[model samples]
Target: MELRYSPFDFTVHEDPYPFYARLREEAPVYHNEKDGFWALSRHADVLAAFRDDRRFSSRNGIRIEEPFWGPQAEQFFSFVAMDPPKHTRMRGLVNKAFTPRRIAALEPRLLEIARAHLEPLLEGEEFDLIDFAAKYPTDVISELVGVPESDREQVREISFAVMHAPEEGDGQMHEGSTDAMGALIGYYAQLTAERARRPQDDLLSGLLQVSENEDRLTPEEVIGVLVLLIGAGSETTMLLLGNAWHAAWKHPAERERAFAGRIEDWIEETLRYDPVSQSSPRTTTEDVELHGVTIPAGEKVLLLSGAANRDPRAFPDPDRFDLDRDTGGHLAFGNGRHHCLGAPLARLEARLALTELAATVADYEIDEAAAKRVHTSINRGFVSLPTRVTARR
Candidate 1:
């Protein structure tokens, strides 16, 4: 079957796996005329492209856009959309902040926030899980990363707007989306300066004090890192939580098993089954052969991480969300050097969020008809999820 996939398909918004499965099986390296990009779907092919930076560069950009945010998008400076030397140096500076120890340290605080958010929902009959469940990761990261309490609300708004820009662009830049992004930049700038003046015990402070010998990032680079850190840091994990919840609610027996100490496998299955980032974009640096298709230099390539995770050749019963299967080789986090730096943090957040949701609320069901799917060329998520939560208490 020839799969026809579009960024704006409502059918995909409902369930993109079937389309992904077809792509993996029939058209491992398929081209989309409308978008003018080749999509790599099979697990091995997708992983190769992600790892082979010499052939495929991140320079042009990482999204499927003909006229992306002309200048305001700011992804050019982001580590997500840069090539080596620059990508390496910038990533090194920020990597200091996301160290395993720091993420581990944030666990207690993350749990506290999770518990606080879940408290009100337990008392209510029904509520939006996206707002209450999927929404908390960024908020928690903002605090953990040292964005002040006063500016955190603006942080969430801008992060969401900038990250979830409508097809046109970030809503704020869209004539009248909001004044939040400007405020966020202003606050981040302040935080940046504050760290410079009086270095504290946090990531921002560390960025400010990065050694000159270690290849310092410019202030713009710093802002770009912060943008990726705050946005990428939370949005994808939030999707995982929301998507996993949707999955478990759809499969009650599996949901029960998840609640009963088998949650990690269920979470992995959810990621493999429905990843937040369905695809990542790359620009070819040289002529490359992808499954018999010749992609000339400068041609755009879409690494379909979601499709690869569900490729039958790579996974038995690819479409089935079975935790019993080995999900270790899945490319949900991409493969190779550009593999997500924040993945460990994302997993921790999901494990906590899912375990808590499963453990609490005696009965829960997703209001599928009422749920809203947030769409972007890169990330997939719920705009909102209205769910009825039956309290264990």
Candidate 2:
């Protein structure tokens, strides 16, 4: 069979479900010669890949393309690319801030932030949901992570530039990420220095205080943790808000059901039907066999999360958005050990954003023709989605 690459073709990005459905049937584990990578499209296969650490290693790195910063990129962003022991150690320190109770406590604050942005929209004729709705979660996450409100925009801008940087080159990709990353690293380093001088109650201070039997996180490790937390926590939430709203406007009935306090099902349905982040890459540590295909060691593997989420064998009427289907097993947050550490936080942000929007914005619609998509190998969301919304009774 000929190799099939998904992200390269703009047509596929436009409507990937049809092609994804075909992939589920023909090539659950697909090898694309064009990109020199393998893609897994079925839920079972993707989940298996996510769980099997020894066979499919993250050491070759998680990104599909080379890091813009060259070798340093791996050092700075290697948390996601690490295997057990190191993965466990790094994740343990950072995971403290994202506990269920902590995220649950954030709901009221998130709701307040959502309400604050939405109130101005009520008086205005129209506003961009991507600016307000999508931005709400970033603000909330920043606050939770101890980022000053004034610096949040700068942080988000840096993240946006790097996260949505074009796949075609690595020049601006490195420069932009390096500058933004420098700002973040400097901010955290200064913060850590201050904490050392005069400690306080915050996530950073808490991180500074954590010691793992003489394995405490170094300043560099602290920077890495903060970088990972801020970007992952904020960006994914923003995407979920944007993606969910886009899906709701596309399906009016689904929107109505969602507005009526019937959101859990619809949100999960939307995730399975149209997830924000599609694929995450992994590398093979050894030669692997899948359905008669031989994938050589040290090759890149892309786990098509969005494609697998909509696999027909797993979800009936996979292309259709049915608010009633069971979508709990979707790979929207990935699976197993490296599953999204902020899954609870991301879910809370989306649930609150979608539910609050449905309740407050009595009538709203996305400007389909004008809406733009942010193209990246990993993250998928909107660049701008001008939406018109009215206040509810």
Question: Best by lDDT, which number?
Answer: 1
Backbone clashes in each candidate structure, one number apiece? 0, 0
- What lDDT tens digits, residue by residue, belong to model 2 across residues 1-393? 453555656556667777777787887778777567788888889989989988876765545555432234445564676888888888887766446776677678778887887777667757887787456766776667677778878766766664565555321244565566677677767766776677665667667778767767776777777777666676677777778888888888988888888877766877788887788788788899988888899887888998888877788777787788888788988888888777777777778777767776787877889988766566677878898876777
Predicted structure 2: lDDT: 0.73
Candidate 1 residue-wise lDDT, 1-393, digit = tens: 346886556667677778877787678778877766788888888888888998987776555554432233444238777778867877777786668998888888888888888778767788898777555887777866688767777777777775555645321124222344455566677778777788777777777667547567666677667766766777788888888888888878877788888878988888888788888888787888866788888787888888888888888887776667798887778878788898888888888877787777777877888988876666777878899877776
In the order shown, the candidates' Cα RMSDs to the true structure are 2.6, 2.4
Which residue pairs in candidate 1 collide?
none
Q: Tell me how far the alpha carbon of residue 231 in candidate 2 is from the true structure, in angstroms, after superposition.
A: 2.4
Candidate 2: which pairs clash?
Answer: none
Per-residue lDDT for 294 in model 1? 87
